[model samples]
Target: MANILEIKNLTKIYKEAQNEICVLKDVSFSVEQGKFIVFIGPSGSGKTTLLNLIAMLDKTTSGSIIFKDKDLTKIDENLAAKTRLLDMGFVFQFDALLPEFTVLENILMPAIIANKKAKTYAKYLLEKFGISHLANKFPPSLSGGEKQRAALARALINKPTILLADEPTGNLDTQRKEQIFKDFAQTAKEEGTTILMVTHDIHAANYADKCYKIEGGKVE
Candidate 1:
């Protein structure tokens, strides 16, 4: 598989009151197409910060993030937003589905934003996640697992080149978390969508094709 994203000597810092705190220090890695990569670390170890940098949700203090031969660290927010919408999908631990919309509508939000018809693919994703029956229900009416499943479907509705998830199964039970990991693995294997997930669940690393650990603001 080819490299979908590359991070070289990436670093992030926070300065307050004349004190400098380093979150991610010279972290480097490459995500290949169709592979599941997980970062396992303790709290405050910069896992989410790293994900934010990769997703363009935050800026890097130094170094470079390259995607498709372009350096994302140098891009303007407009271009970054456009690139994120066009090439990336993000799933947070909480199911961020819209309450006013039905599950189907929530799943189609990406397509609606892009002004493209994705009903067929959205339905396929719902079926694939075994929640086709819940499509017509509102988010508040669904269970946690169901909501997360719908969120997963929504994330994939755009068929992005990569998916960035931050502790995606944190709100679920063990059984549900296992199911989510299986679904994530299957998605990467079948649809060839690159997956980068950050979680403290060491067990979750089992389902990933590549696993890295972060300690003292460095990844290995």
Candidate 2:
């Protein structure tokens, strides 16, 4: 498969009033198209920062994030936002579902933002994830696992080419976590979606096509 995303000599640094904190240093890797990639690390590791840089949510100190041959580090904020909405899906540590909206409405948020008719697709995703019965329920009324599942469905509603997940299964139990891992693996296999996930859970390595360990600001 072709390389869907490439991280070449990536570095990220933060300044805290005369103190310099380098979270990532000279990291490099590539994600193949339709492959499930997992990064594991402890807290304060650069794993989350790595995802942020790829998602263009944060600026890179120096490096080239080559996505489809374009340098993400060099893109303007407007283009970055558009790329994120149109080509990438994200599931953060928290579900981040809107409390005021019904489950179905929340799942349709991205489609609404993109102005695409995806209601039917959203329904299909809900059913696929076994959450069709909860479509009319609100986030506040759902359990942690249910909320997480809804968040996953929402992320996929746009059918993004790449899914960036940060500890996405933290809210679920072992069984649910494994189910989600299987779902991610299947998504990559059947739909050609490239998945880049960061988690503290070592079990995720079992489901990933490629796995990396990040520690002390470097990836191995």
Candidate 3:
């Protein structure tokens, strides 16, 4: 498989009270197309920060992030935003679903924003993730697992080339977490979507094709 994402000598720092706190230092990695890669670490280990940088939600202090052959570090805000919409899908620890929208509506939100055709794909994902029955229901009415599944469906609405997940199973029970991981693995295998996930659970990381542990701002 070809490289879908690459990070080289990445570093991030936050200044507070005349002191610099380093979040990431000289970190590097590459993700291949159609592969599942997980970053495992303890709390405050910069996993989320790394994901944010890769998703273009946050800027890096220094270094390069290449996605689909483009150096994201050199892109302007407008181009970065466009790239994110065109090539990236993100699922957070929180479902981030709109309370006012039904499950189906939430799933289609990305497509609506991009003015893309997605009804058929949305319905298929909803059914595939076993959330079809809750299509008309609101987010508040669903369980954590159901909400995450809906969020996953929404993420895929754009059919992005890369999916970035931050602790996707953090809020689910063990059984539900296992089921979701299985679904995610199957989806990656069948659709050839590149996935980079941040997880703390060893069992969850086991589902990934490759795993890296982050500590003290470096991959171990």
Candidate 4:
């Protein structure tokens, strides 16, 4: 498998009260195509910050991020946004579904925004994730697991090459978390999707192809 994402000497800093808070420092990693990599760490360990940088949702203070052979750190905001829409799928710790839209509609929202033809595939994903029964229901009516599954379906609707998940199973119970991880693993395998997930649960990290532990802004 070829490298799909690369990070070199990544660092992120935040300014607060005349002090510099270093969130990440000298982090370097690479993710291969069709592989699932998990980052596990305790709270406030900068895992989320790393994910944000990788997803291009936040800028790095310094370093290089190469995705699909292009250097993201050097790109303009417009190009970064375009790249994110075209190639990245994100699952937040929370479902982040729209309360006004039905499950199907929520799943189709990304495709609509990207102006991509994906209605048919969205339906297929809904069925694959076993959320077809709730397709017409709203987000508030669903269980946590159900909502997460719906969110996953929406993220995948665009058939993204890379899926970035932030504590994807954080809100679920043990059984549901296991089920969701299984679903994620199966879907990534079938779709040849490269997944980079930030999680705290050791069991959840076990579901990934590889796992790294981040502490004090460095991977251990």
The per-model lDDT (C-alpha) reads 0.92, 0.92, 0.90, 0.90
Q: What RMSD does model 3 have?
A: 0.9
Evaluate candidate 2 by giving its C-alpha RMSD to the native, one decimal.
1.0
lDDT by residue (tens digit), candidate 3, 114-173: 989899999999999999999999999999999999999998889899999999999899
lDDT by residue (tens digit), candidate 2, 105-188: 999999999999999999998988889999999999998878888998899889999999999998789998998899899889
Q: RMSD (Cα, Å) of candidate 4?
A: 1.0
Q: What is the lDDT of residue 14 in candidate 4?
A: 93
Best by TM-score: 1
**Residue pairs clashing, model 4:** none
Clashes of 4: 0
Task: Write down the TM-score for model 4.
Answer: 0.97
- Which 10 residues in a row give candidate 4 its minimum summed lDDT? 179-188
Model 1 residue pairs with clashes? none
* Residue 73 CA displacement from its true place in model 2, Å: 0.4
In candidate 2, how many Å is residue 202 off? 0.4
Candidate 3: deviation at residue 216, Å? Answer: 0.6
lDDT of 4 by residue, 17-47 (tens): 9999998989998888988888889999998
The model with the greatest lDDT is 2
Ranking by lDDT: 2, 1, 3, 4
